[model samples]
Target: MSWAVLVISGVLEAVWAAALDRSEGFSRPLPSVVFGIALAGSMGGLAYAMRELPLGTSYAVWVGIGAVLAVAYAMITGAESVSVLKVLFLAMIVGGVVGLKALH
Candidate 1:
């Protein structure tokens, strides 16, 4: 359950980040609201997850998932240019996350 919450939080982090990017410096009403909600929700979820998970492990996984998802989202949405080197780096991040998970 804690891990699940962490993953959700991470995904929410990505969502909020993307929302913030579209907020036009907070001038856009709808995107601003969405950004606020998602940002708060992500932090709230992370707090809940930290109750049971070790801080180091939880933080690493949370950040890793958020970063990877955000980059992938940007590439897929055409918000950023996708390149072979970028994809390779993203794959390395995924690999690191999986390796960390496999650690005792």
Candidate 2:
């Protein structure tokens, strides 16, 4: 349950990050609301997961998942360029996240 929540939170982190970019310094109404909502949910989930998971491991996993997904989404949407090197590095991060999960 905790791991599930953590993953959801990580995905939400990406959601919030993308929304924040579209928020235009938080001046836009809809994107601003999305950002605020996702931010709260992501933080809440992280805090909840930390109750059972080790802080360092949990936080690192959360960040890795979020960063990878955010960049992937941006690339997919043409908001950012995709490259072989970029994908290779993202795969490395994915591998590390999997390794950490295997550890626990």
Candidate 3:
């Protein structure tokens, strides 16, 4: 359950990140609201997960998931350019996340 929450929170981190970018410094109402809601959810989930998981492992996993998803989202939406090297690096991050999970 804790791991599930942590993963969900990680995805929410990406959502909030993308929404924040769309918020344009909080100038946009809808995106800003989305950002706020997602940010709260993400943090709440992270805090909850930390209750059962080691801090360093949880943090690294959370950040890894969020970073990969955020950049993937940007690339898919054409907000960021995609490249072979970028994909390769993202795969490496995913590998590290999986490795942590396996170790845990």
Candidate 4:
């Protein structure tokens, strides 16, 4: 259950990160509100999951998931360009996340 919560939190982290990009520095109303709420909810879920999880492991996994997802989205959505090197870096993030999950 804690891992599930952490995964959900990771997904929400991606959603909120995308929302933040679309918010245009909070000039946009709807996306800004959604971004704020999603960010808070993501943190809340992380806190709940941390009750039973090791802090270092859980936090690393959570951030890694978010980083990989965000980079993928950026590549797909043209917000950021993709390259072989960048993809390799993202792969490393995935490996780190997986390694943490395996340990946990």
Best by lDDT: 3
Q: List the residue pairs that clash in candidate 2.
A: none
Q: For model 1, what is the C-alpha lDDT against the true structure?
A: 0.89
TM-score for each model: 0.92, 0.98, 0.98, 0.95
Is candidate 1 or 3 superior in TM-score?
3
Between candidates 2 and 3, the one scoring higher on lDDT is: 3
- Model 2 quality (TM-score): 0.98
lDDT of 3 at 57: 87
Q: Per-model C-alpha lDDT, please?
A: 0.89, 0.95, 0.96, 0.91
Task: Indicate the residue-level lDDT of 76 in model 4.
Answer: 100
Look at candidate 1 and give me any clashing residue pairs. Answer: none
lDDT of 3 by residue, 1-104 (tens): 99999999999999999999999999999999999999999999999999999999899999999999999999999989999999999999999999999999
What are the runs in model 3 whose C-alpha is more than 4 Å off?
Answer: none
How high is the lDDT of residue 23 in model 4? 99
lDDT (Cα, tens digit) per residue for candidate 1, span 13-102: 998998999999999999999999999989999999889887888888888889999999999999889999999998998898777678
Q: Encode model 2's per-residue lDDT on 1-104: one tens digit a residue.
A: 88999999999999999999999999999999999999999999999999999998789889999999999999999999989999999999999989988999
